[model samples]
Target: MPTFTALTTLADGEKARALAESMEEMDPTPDGVGVFEMEDGSGLWEVGGYFTEAPDEVALSLLAAAYGARPFAVSELPDTDWVAKVRRELVPVQAGRFFVYGSHDADKVPEDCVPLLIEAAMAFGTGHHGTTLGCLRALDRLMNAGIEARNVADIGCGTAVLAMAAAHVWPRPVLASDIDPVAVEVAEANAAVNGLSEKVICVEAAGFDHPTLAAAAPFDLVFANILKGPLIDLAPSMAESTAKGGHVILSGLLVEQAEEVIAVYSAAGYSLAHREDIVDWSTLTMRRE
Candidate 1:
């Protein structure tokens, strides 16, 4: 079956989110909608929707106009084996000592690096994106610094690649949680494929809301690769959940927004330990003291 996509851009995050929400109520509603900050540092937010059927161009245009966004660009995607295409195109990504690959590239995994099998699917964090890559590199730096984390949590973990990477080095269970249940399932599958099902526990929760996460309080290390808004909002909770002298790795924000995030975390009792900028994304490692 053919698929369709409609995309628009606006300067305001609120409008972009509102426009994406409105796409959900449209006739021939989208299978999914997303609002993401453009990494170009244009202060633009992209709102996009995907549909199994052709989306209503007129409705999309109207929504864009209402939201003060650019005209919606709608396209009909060619019918093809998207999964196979992804598998063929997404080569294994290496960050520091970690290697992220799909089942298709299983043979390409290096014996010297930590291998994390993340099948090309609906979830995020395959380590190809700059955000995930930066996070992995930051984690590797921490490991190289002789930091040992007995307890770890990966909040908003998509494929749980980061959690699995930590599990590969630390002899402890790594808690991985995501707001989306589908992501949680993907994380579990990825962990199983990486032979880390026992070490990387997956759960569905927003930030640190789950009882399982709450019970495992004061994590030695935490990974939050979510967006800037959620990261800022999570500062206080992150500080509370992190043990003294623990570490937090944050990403999914543009490089330009790093200072703002740092300031917020600083107020929450976190001091920046390391910062790595890859392309347009910035990954921050903060120490709780």
Candidate 2:
């Protein structure tokens, strides 16, 4: 059955409470319908879900009339039988000497990663995204040069998937950070799932400028898969934290934006070593001078 969800937000809690009283529950035809809200100190936001085969036109009109500013999204729940079909067709990726498994093939990851399912959620890094694959390929190329490190860090570590991949290949202590706490939890879980929790440290931090990160300075390698604006902003800090012969892998920029990001690092004593492009985003690898 198709499900409809309407999102609403009130500038204040009083409006939220008042609006809640107006919701209807008469001709309910599905498993259930409900309202969910979360308050983040900024304001209260709610999503009202209605599960009905027939459109609740009258009720919807009433809510729309009272609160026309509310937005809605409609989505259908997929059948369980199609899970395999969906997985196979939507996600398959390979980069460098690594094969990331988010594929529909139940066992998409090769024997080496046989233990890791590589379940592809909406998480940040799956190596399925072009940027992530670009990073992987860059890492593999670096590997060919007999690169190994005692310390590594991944910035904007969404889901920490790449960090996990790194831990699997190298025994180094990997530092992973994200500003989002939810992402920190997910990354930690992913590391543990892949038996890398002990080797990877997940923290809620932003930028390479933090005191703790600065104290741990001069990592052998750093992986940052964030967009150009921030990359440009943090170039000096990132370069400063890199060991003299270490490298920085950067992503989250369009092919056109690479030069701008590269210019920032290059000006700070880093030399460009490699570049990878997928779709519109490009990833660049640089070695500190």
Candidate 3:
């Protein structure tokens, strides 16, 4: 069974979303449709759809033109075991004392390093992306600096990797939450696989909205590895949820967007303590004032 994909970009997010919705009505309707803002600071939104059969290119072109977007680029993707391929290609990643790898790479885990097992099927926060890796490194640095957090929360935790990392270093239970239920499920599964199921609690919540998160307020350390817009929107809530003098680790921002994010966090009474740029992404560690 072959899969097909059609992708296009536009400057307007609303238009991109509308286009994605419209793609559902097309012949050979897409199995999935997604609209997301480009994280490159380009102010563009990408609209994409996955189809079981080849999509009509002429219809896609017409739809793109209607929305004033770039012509849709359609591609046929041959059926392949993507999870197996990811397992083979994604080697273990070492960020400070934390080592992230899949079970296939179990032999590569070092004796002295803290190991986090994230399977290739759940690939979002497998320490392969710069944002996740940056957060782990930031946590490692904080630990090295004699900062021990009693309560920690991993906001927008994709695979609970950050939460597990925090639990590994600290004795307290860590809270991990994601807006998507599937991610929360994946996070819980990852926690169990890493043998930190009791230490890391996975919940489905938008930001700090759940009862579990509310009861665990004033976190000593918080990790928000989501994109720029959500990070900005989360500043006030994050500040309110964090304890005074607590630490916040943020990533999923472009180098150019870091200063704006810093300014927002500063207004929320946070000062940048450290910043690292890994390729095009910028990660910042801040202390709440």
lDDT of 3 at 193: 88
Residue runs of model 1 more than 4 Å from their true location after superposition: 10-21, 37-45, 65-69
Residue-level lDDT of model 3, residues 149-213, one tens digit each, is: 99999999999999999999899999999999989999999999889999999989999999999
Tens digits of per-residue lDDT for model 2 on 67-182?
54254444555434444554555565667667666534545556653233355453447776778888888888888889986788999988776677677788777889887788
State model 1's lDDT.
Answer: 0.91
Q: Per-residue lDDT for 1-289 in model 1, tens only?
A: 9889898899999888988888999999899999888766688999999999989898888898899999998999999997878877889999999988888888999999988888876436789899999999999999899999999999999888899999999999999999999889988998888899999999999999999999999899999999888999999899999999999999998889999999999999999999989888899999999
Q: Who wins the TM-score comparison?
A: 3
Model 2 clash pairs are: 87-104, 88-104
TM-score ranking from best candidate downward: 3, 1, 2
Question: What lDDT does the true structure give each of the candidates?
Answer: 0.91, 0.71, 0.94
Candidate 2 backbone clash number: 2
Task: Report the C-alpha displacement of residue 140, candidate 1, in angstroms.
Answer: 1.6
Arranged by lDDT with the best first, the candidates are 3, 1, 2
TM-score of each: 0.90, 0.69, 0.96
